[model samples]
Structures are given as C-alpha cells and as structure tokens.
Target chain A: MKKILNDPAAVVAQSLLGLAAAHPDLLRVTTDPAVVSRADGPRPGKVAVVSGGGSGHEPLHGGFVGPGMLDAACPGAVFTSPTPDQIQAAVSRVDGGAGVLLLVKNYTGDVLNFETAAELLAADGVDVRTVLIDDDVAVRDSLYTAGRRGVGATVLVEKVVGAAAEAGADLATCERVARAAVAGARSMGIALTAPTVPHVGEPSFTLADDEMEVGIGIHGEPGRRRERLTDADGVVAALLEPVLADLPFAAGDEVLLFTNSMGGTPLLELYLAHGIAEQSLVDKGITVTRRLVGPYVTSLEMQGMSLTLLRLDDELTRLWDAPVRTAALRWGA
Target chain B: MKKILNDPAAVVAQSLLGLAAAHPDLLRVTTDPAVVSRADGPRPGKVAVVSGGGSGHEPLHGGFVGPGMLDAACPGAVFTSPTPDQIQAAVSRVDGGAGVLLLVKNYTGDVLNFETAAELLAADGVDVRTVLIDDDVAVRDSLYTAGRRGVGATVLVEKVVGAAAEAGADLATCERVARAAVAGARSMGIALTAPTVPHVGEPSFTLADDEMEVGIGIHGEPGRRRERLTDADGVVAALLEPVLADLPFAAGDEVLLFTNSMGGTPLLELYLAHGIAEQSLVDKGITVTRRLVGPYVTSLEMQGMSLTLLRLDDELTRLWDAPVRTAALRWGA
Candidate 1:
C-alpha cells in the first residue's frame, strides 16, 4: 500500500511522536505504556475523561485529548484495541481526586480491554465508570462487534461528556450525559473506496469502480450491501433514511448534524454531503441546531463519509456548546 | 472517478451552498457573483482582506473568510480562476472605508483576474492594494505560473495578514506584512497520486505503483521530477531540504513550520511528516516556535503533502498568535 509511513510496525509509535511534536503545548506523550495526556492534566478537583481504541481513526481518541475534552488517550495499533496495561496507565495518570470516566466504543476487543482496565483501576480504590457508544445503525451484529459498531457518535459522546466532566460533574453525571448522547444519536456511512491497513499492505476489502458499499464499517469491513454508485443526494437518502427512522426524530426536534469523512474524501465533498444531509433532515421536520462538517472520525485513507444525528435537549445542547480545545474539534476556546 | 458530488458542473456552487449552510453563523454566500463574506463584515475603519482562487483547494479562500481573516472570498470553478467580476463584487461588498487588501496567489489566471479586479475597484474610487504570494520552491516556472507556483504559503499569508488587518493595520501596512510573509516563506510538495477534476472525469496525470512525483503543484501539474516511491522520512527530507535551502533560514531564527496535506493524505501521515520536518529544522539549528499542520490548503483528494517554513520576526510571531476565528483555522479565539 502507498502510505506515508516509516515502518508499518512503527506507524502508531511514530505517528504519536509526530502528534506530540506538533502539539507540545497541548499534549504530552508517554512511552513504555503508551498514553497521551493533557500537558497540564490531573486537574485537582475535576473528573478525568479518557478514551481510546485503534490508531487508524485519528483525531478520535488522541486528537480529542485536551482541556475540555479527553484528559488522556491510550491508542493501540491500527484497528487493534489497546492493552489493559496501557489503558490503566492512562487512567492512573489523569485520574484527579474526583473520579475517571472511560469512553469505550462497542467493539469486542475494546470492550474487553477497557473493562479489564476499569476493574484494575477499581481495585486501587479509584472511582471509574465506562460508557459504551454503539450508535452505528449499519450493523446489527458483526465479526468484531455485537449490537452495533460504534462509529461517528463516539465524537459526540466524547464532546458532550467531556464538557460535563469539565463543568465539575461527578462521575455519575458524566456517565449519564455520555449515555444520553449515545441514546439520542445514530450514524451510518458508505465507502467509495476501501482503506489498506499499513501492516497488511492490502485493502481489507475491494470495490469495483462502479460500485460502493452502502453501510461500511470504519475498519474496512463489509457493509450491509454493495450497490451501484449513485449521486450525492441518492447516497445521502440511503444513509439518512435508516438513521432518521431508527432515531424516530420528530418534527421541531433540535439536533446537531455531523458529517464526517472516512479519511480520503475532501472537504468539498463533505460539505456537499452536509448540504444534502441537512436538507433531508429539514424535510423530515427536524431542526438542525448545530452542524459539524469535516473528517472527525476517519479510517486510513478510506474514501467515504458518515452522517451522525444527535437529538439535543437543553442540557445536552449546553454541554455541546461548552468550550473545547483539542488538536481537532476546537471551538469557543 | 469516485467523488461525492452532484452534476460535476454544479460542484462549486453546491458546495458553497453547503458551506454557507454549515457556517451561517460565521459566513454568508452570495450567488451570481458567488462571493463568500463574513456574516458580520465590513468592519468600519479596519482594512478588509479579500482572497480567492480556483475552488478545489478548500478552506483556503472560502473557509478562511470569517472574523480576523478574509472579509470576503470569491471561488471559481474547480482548478479554474474566478472571473474578474466576481472578485470585484467581493471587493465592493467588503471595502469598509479603510480600503481593501487583495491577497492573490501567483497563478497566471488568479493574478490576471485579481489585478483586473483591483483596477476596477480602484476606478470605482475605492482604495485597493494587491499582495502576491509565490512561495513555492517547486518549479522556477511552470505551464500555469511564471515565477513560482503559489502553493501552501497562501494559507500563511491569509492568516498573518488577516491578523494584521484585524489588528487595525492600514492598507499599506497590511500589504507590507503580506509581502514580508511571502518573502520569508518557502514551500515544496510531493504527490503519491493525482487528483481528478470533477468535470474532467480523469486524473490530471498518472504514476506507476512504485513512482511518485516530487515538487508538484497543486493542480496536479508535473513537479521537479518523478522518483521511486520512498518512506515518509525520505520524502520529508526531499521536500524540506529544498524549502530550507531556498529560504536559507539561519540558526537561532524562529519559524512557523507548516506541513499541509495536498488533500487525501490523512492526519496520521501529516503528523508523522510534521515530526520529521520539525527534526530536520532543529537539526539545521533553526528553532520551530510554531506549527500549523493538516490539510489547510489542498488539491481535490490528491495523495500528497507539502512543507512550508515561514521565517518569523517579533511582529509576524505576535500576529500569528493573534485571535482569529475562521472555519478551518482557529486558535486563541
């Protein structure tokens, strides 16, 4: 595969080094047990937020670590869950006296490892809670996940819960806010091209020039089905139809619309997708109160985009509007 | 080509509509003339900054139109310069009585059109000055450019000059600061793949699986030469070496190191490149005091990255740290 990397095996370590170099004022990276923490972390009386998964979906766990977002992030290798030791190390480093909240995406390896970390941390008398995000409507079950695979909504969970934690919420309140975000949100994505894992050096799946995957997962896994390529509007309809129906959002309900690129899609296309997605939601009587359009959570050079809708309540809206300063997803800071 | 678009002919207009919809709080788009202006613009007594070019390099001219940046932006068709009338219309709309500063990239069409617009606005009794950015150290001359092709440094120009404008610099002062930025900055890029123009329906160029182009332009134009694909470090070395030597940056000098994605390169790779580029600079005894990484300027999904180094004085450094809130670049705001 054509990738800008030093060694396939060193992708995670090297990229983290780069990330640390790029944002030294914002992040601090620790080796041995790899974890990225806020430069001035361990806020004396605030609940610490930690999140992680595979490394490919950048700007997710690591990029989201900062003042009003994740306090620490433990990134594993591409598409592989971080080990329990790594997660525990991250949690320990960022856990202020208040408590610690772990945002775990609903993947088997991630769930197992984060749970193990939580148990290990609890043994040390640290208050720890885990919030699972499974907002992808594309899958009912998968080879690597049960229920649904977490996708774009992980960003929403992190943002809202991070805000709550920053606002002096206790562990229970932060956990509740995170759960609310997951409950109110749904996401779906499609792939025009598959991404290659660096170590594998080949695409996990293949698609013809005239075909696209309708409900592709983030890790280049097979989606719900393959279909002939269509226009932006048609693709938006297919993805949003399932998401809107699943959420059963009613007229006049306010929501935050997030259009995310899967990696290789340009902002030009993502903005076009945002326009189409916004119109589709408006036609359904939903009011898009806030809109975020970019490559937030992405695969490795995968040409695709995902639509996420988070039905907003007053409290959720307030939390969503809070100041956040991270490598990615910064506003009002 | 697989792209998220409607009719290729409508790409620019539709995408601008999406951009307007997504950032109505920050931007406003006017059709016919097709100008994107700040939602609260024409700040009286402050020099207005206006920029424009071809459409494909997003978040450059358009996304950079907001508070503390461009007061207006005019976008042409993909990879095609906007007409003179469009530029004039934007200039007229944002001339807040303190005169207007036009930041033009050094492309043949862009320079011609922006110059024509400057004359038109001048004849209309509005004071106007133009600053040209030609920092690309790629080709000394090319098919579409005379001196050097303006590449990634246009973003730096807009940002530094925009900050100066927001700080109440007069038209002449803004022009001077912009010219200084252009003089002190140099950039070079390499492409792993070419981008396809939407209407063209084919890549502007092609490369073998083991080949890559070095010192490439943003429009997929040929670079310095084609060479065997290499690791990220080798590529970074090839790019930074030329840029550093061209600027002849000296030891003890502080610089803003910018590593930009041509388009399709992921944040993972960009951060890796940033690390490599920063080390190369430090090795030369130059101190990198600031960094701006990511796809600030891009070709439409081209797989490449560029390195830009802006020699910073105290004024440029202070202006760089100034609060500016644009759609793409935001910090300390």
Candidate 2:
C-alpha cells in the first residue's frame, strides 16, 4: 500500500507527537499508554467525559479531546481496541471530583476493554458510567460486533453528550443525553474502495472495478450486499432507505442529517450526495432542521460516504447548538 | 472514476447546491453565475476579498468564504478556470464601497481570467486590485503555470490577507499584505498516487507501485523528479529541504507551519509528517509560532500531502491569530 508513513508499527505514537506539537495549547499527549487529554488541568467538580477506540478513524475520539468534547482519549493502534490499561490511564488523567463517563462504541473489543477499565475505576472509588452507541442500521451483527456496530452517530453523541457534561451536568445527566443520542440515531454507508491498514500493507478486501459494497463497516468488513456501482442518487437512496425505514421517521419529524465521507471521497462528491439526501428527506415530509456534511467518522482512506439521521427533540437541538471547540468539531466559543 | 457523483459535468453546480443547503447561515450561493458569498450583507466600507479558481481543490476558494475571510468565491468546473463572467458576478455580489481585492493563483488561466474580470470591473468604475500567489518551490514553470505554481501557501495568504482586509485595511494595505505573504511563503508536495478528474475518468498522472513524485503540483503536473517511495521521514526531508532553501529561512525566524493532506491521505499520516517537520525546524532554531494542519487545500482524492511555511512578522501573526469563521478554517471566532 502506498501511504505517507514510516514503520507501520509506530504510526499511533508518532502521530500523537505530531498532534501534540500542532496544538499544544489545546492538548497534552502522553505516549506510554497513548492518552490525549486537555492541556488545561482537570476541573475539581465537573463531570469528566472520556472516549476512545482504534486509530484509523482520525479526528474522532482523540481530535475531539478538549473542554467541550472528550476530556481524554485513549487511541489504540489502527482498527484495534485500546488495552484496558490505556483506558485506565485516560481515566486517571481526566477524573475530576464529580465523576467519569465513558462513551464506548458497540464493537465487541471496545465494549470488553471499556468494561474492564470501568471495573478497575470502580475499585479505585471513581464514579464512572458507560453509554454504548450502536446506531448503524446496516446489520444486527458483524465481524467485530455483537450487534449493530456504532458508526457516524458516535460523533453526534460525543458532541451532544459532551456539551451536557461541559454545562456542569452530573454523571447521570450525561449518561441520559448519550443514551438518547444513541437511540435516536441510525447510519448506513457504501464503500467504493477499501482501506489498507498500515501493518497489513494491502487492502483488507477487494472489489471489482464496477462493484460497490453497501452497508460496509468501518474496518472494511463485508456489508449487506455487493452490486454494480451507480450514480450518487442511487447510492443515496440505497443508504437512506434503510436508515429512514429502520427509524421509521414519519412526516413532520425534524432531524439532524449528517452526511459523512468514509475517507477517500472528496468533499465535492460528498456534498453532492448530501444535497440528494436533503432533497429526499424534504420529499418525505421530514424537516431537516440541522445538517452536518464532511468526514467526521471515517475508515482509513476508504472511498465512500455514510449518512446518519438523528431524530432531534428540543433538548437535543439545544445541546447540539451549544458551543463546542474541539479540534474536529468547532463552533461557537 | 469511482466517485460518488452524477453526471460528471454537473459536479460543480450540484456540489454548490449541497454547500448552500449545508451552510445557509454562513453562505449565500447563487447557481447562475456560481458565486458563494457571505449570507450577511456585505460591509459597505470594508475592502471585499474575492477569490476563485478550478473546482477540484475542495475548500480552497469556496470553503474559505465567510466572515473575516473571502467576501465571495467563484468555483469553476474541475481543473478548469472559472469564466470572467462568473468572477464579475462575484465582484458584483460582494463589492463594497471600499473596493475589491481579487486573489489569483499563478496559473495561466487564473491570471488571464482574473485580469479580464478586473478590467471589466474597472471599466464600470469599480476600484479593483489583484494579488497573485506564486509560492510553490517546485518547478519554475509547468503545464498550466508560467511561474512557480501556487499550492498550499494560497491558503495561508488567504487567511492572513483576508483577516487584514476584514480589519478594515484599505485596498493598498490589503494588497501589500497579500504580496508580503506571497513573497514570504514557500511550499513543496509529494504525491504517492495521482488524482482523477471526473470528466476524464482517469488519474491525472500515474506512478509505479514503489515510486512517488516529489514536488508534485496540486493538479498532478510533473514535479521536480520521480523517485522510489520512501519512509515518512525521508519524504518529510525531501519536502522540507526544497521549501527551506527556496525561502532561505533563517535560524532566528518565527513562522507558521501548515501541514496539508492532498485529499486522500489520512490525518494519521499527515500528522506524522508534521511532527517530523516540527522537530526539523526546532533543530534549526526556527520557532513555529503558528500552525495549521489539515486537508484545507486538496486535489480531489490524491494520496499524498504538501508542506507550507509562511515567514511571519508581528502583523501577519496577529492577523493569523484573529477571529475568522469559515467552513474549512475556524478558530477564536
């Protein structure tokens, strides 16, 4: 695989070095266990929210580390779950007097590791809570997941729940917001090309020139089906049909529609797809009051896009509109 | 090309429709002349900064339009210059009483078209000025350029110069800052794989599996040379040496270092290279007082990156640190 990297084994550690140097005022990175926490010291009585996962889906958990989003992030090797020790380190670095909340994706490895870390934290007398995000509507189970694998909704949950935590909410309130976000969101993605893990040195999967995979997982896992690639309208219909049907969102529903690039898809194509999705929702009588378009959650340079629909309520809308200043998603102050 | 698009020819218009839908608060997009202008009414006495170019570069001219940046952006078809009529339209929409400053890249078509637009506006008694960016340290002349091709430094110039214009600097003052930025900045890129234009349905250029092109142009034009692929450290060295020598950066100089991905390269790899660039500068006793790292200037889904270093004085530094909010770059504001 032709990639701009050195030894594949050192990708995460070296990348953190770069990230730390690039934004020293915003983040403090520790390499031993790879925890990226806010540069500002921890608060004495504020709920500390932490999240993490594999490495490749960048600007995700790590880039989201700051005051308005994740307090600390434990990034493991690409596509591999962070060890329990790494998660424990993140908790140790960010735990304030109030409590800790772990935003865990639904993948089996992430679930297991985060659970182990939570047990360890509890033994240390830390009040920690867990929220699992399983918003993908593509499948009930997958290669590395026991249920619908978490996808793009992870970004929405992180933003909304993190805002609640930042607003001085208690651990229970943060957990409630995260659970609501997870329950209200659904995602589906199509892959035009697969990603190559640095160590793997080759594409994980292969598709013929004219074929595309529907409902593909972030790690290049097989999706629902394979078919000849079509235009953006067809692709948008394929992804949105399953997502909208699963949510069964009806007329007069106001929602936040997020159109995401898998990795290699350019913004031009992604925006084109988003336009089609917007029109489709309008025709269905659903009002799209909020929209996000770009690559927030992504595979490692995989070419395609994912669509996530979050059924929004007044509270969720307030949380989303609240100011956030993370490296990935930045807005008001 | 395996792009998520419909009717390759409609790519620009359709993408702009999506852009308008996604960011109604920050932008007002008109399709007939294809101008993306600020949603807020133009500041009557502030110098209007307008820029446009080919559309393949995702966020260069359009995504950078917002408060404290470009007043308007005109995007043409992929890899083709926008017509003079489109530029005239953008000028009409954003021109305030303080006059218009047109930022043009150093490509033949861009220079010719922007000059023609300026002439048309001048004929109508609109006080208009032009600043051309030629900061690429690669080749002196290439397929589409008459001088060093404008690349990553265009983003730096736009951010710094746009901020100056927003601070109420007049036409001459804005032009002076833009020229200083163009003179002070230097860039060099390396591409592992070339980008493909939708209409052409083929890669702009080709490379063997084990080779990469150093000093590669943004449009996939031939660079200084083709060599075997190497590690990230080697690639960083290759890029930094030419950029440093071209600008003749000194030991005590303070600068802004921008590490950019040319579309398909993941942030993981881009940050790694950035880390290396940081250390290299530190070793040379140069202080990087400012930093911007991302895919701001891209060439569709090209698998590589570019490095830009802008020599900074107090004025440029302050302008760079000023509050500016755009779809691609937003901070402080």
Models 1 onward score TM values of 0.99, 0.99
Q: Clashing residue pairs in candidate 2, if any?
A: none
For model 2, the superposed segments whose C-alpha errors exceed 4 Å read none
Off by over 4 Å in 1: none
Report the lDDT tens digits of candidate 2 across residue range B145-261.
998999998888888888998889999999999999999999999999999999999998889999999989888898999999999999999999999998799899999999999
Chain A fold similarity by TM-score, each prediction: 0.99, 0.99
Docking class of 1: high
The TM-score measured for candidate 2 stands at 0.99
Compared with the true structure, all predictions reach lDDT values of 0.91, 0.92
Per-model TM-score of chain B: 0.99, 0.99
